[model samples]
Target: MIEVRAPEPGDLETIGREAREEWVRDRFRTGVDFSPLMDKPNTHVALIDGQPVAAGGFIDRGNGNAIAWSVLGRVDERHFVGLVRAFRKYMKATPYRWIEAHCIATFHQSHRWVKCLGFVPVNGERCFTPDGREFRKYVFRNHNGS
Candidate 1:
């Protein structure tokens, strides 16, 4: 069984390992540095059989908007999909004007995941991380904000 909950510090050990596995699978050009947002009010961990397999959260960007992000750990890919869906529903409940996610332009699965979470791509738009890694930005806004 999978559970989604606000994460505690102890969960980092497993979450970090899972993140390494994800980087290997995704082949991130600049590589990903896994950092759990446990100290943040809007973070969560996805666990299976009592072990964390993924973590994510949104950071308030102020003015009722936020930026979303997630890291999927090494686990049964079949189950991680459920984790993503659960996280999506949880984020939608937040009273934010809009929530956006940034994904590597080459990360096809991330593009798909955001789409499943109801995020539409900001077509023709692109951005770079502080490290200069390019990304595609996606935004999610319920009909109320749409």
Candidate 2:
């Protein structure tokens, strides 16, 4: 069974260390600890049979806007889809007027997954990370929010 709950200490680090993407592992190996973020509101960890698989949350950006983020480890298709469903419910109940997520342009799965969560790509929008990697912006507008 899959469980989605508030992240506990070390959840992010555990997920980061086991991230399926090499870039994500490299980021974690740089000594940056994301465990602290678990204390933030909306942050959550996904576990399967007691093993951490993913962690993420929305960071309120004020003015009815927020940023969505997630880090994944090795996850089976079933749990991944379950996480998507949970995220959709969270978005539906959120008070944010807009929630944005940035996807690494080369990560095709991410692009598709964001769409699965109902985020629309911003036309003509392009963003660059501090390391110079290109990214695309996607936004989810909440018609029910202010």
lDDT of 1 by residue, 1-146 (tens): 88888887656555665564456445333445444356778788888988888777888888788898776667686785687678877787776778899988877877877887889889888799788889999998855432
**Candidate 2 global TM-score:** 0.90
Clashes of 1: 1
Give the runs in model 2 whose Cα sits over 4 Å from its true position. Answer: 144-146
Which candidate gets the maximum lDDT versus the true structure? 2
Instruction: Report the error of model 1 at residue 67, Å.
Output: 0.1
Point out where model 1 deviates above 4 Å: 20-36, 143-146
| TM-score for each candidate, following the candidate numbering | 0.80, 0.90
Q: Residues 30-130, candidate 2, lDDT per residue (tens digit)?
A: 98857556777877787889998887788889999998888878888877778788767767777788999999899887898789889999979779989
Predicted candidate 1: what Cα RMSD to the true structure?
A: 3.9
Q: What does the lDDT come to for candidate 2?
A: 0.83
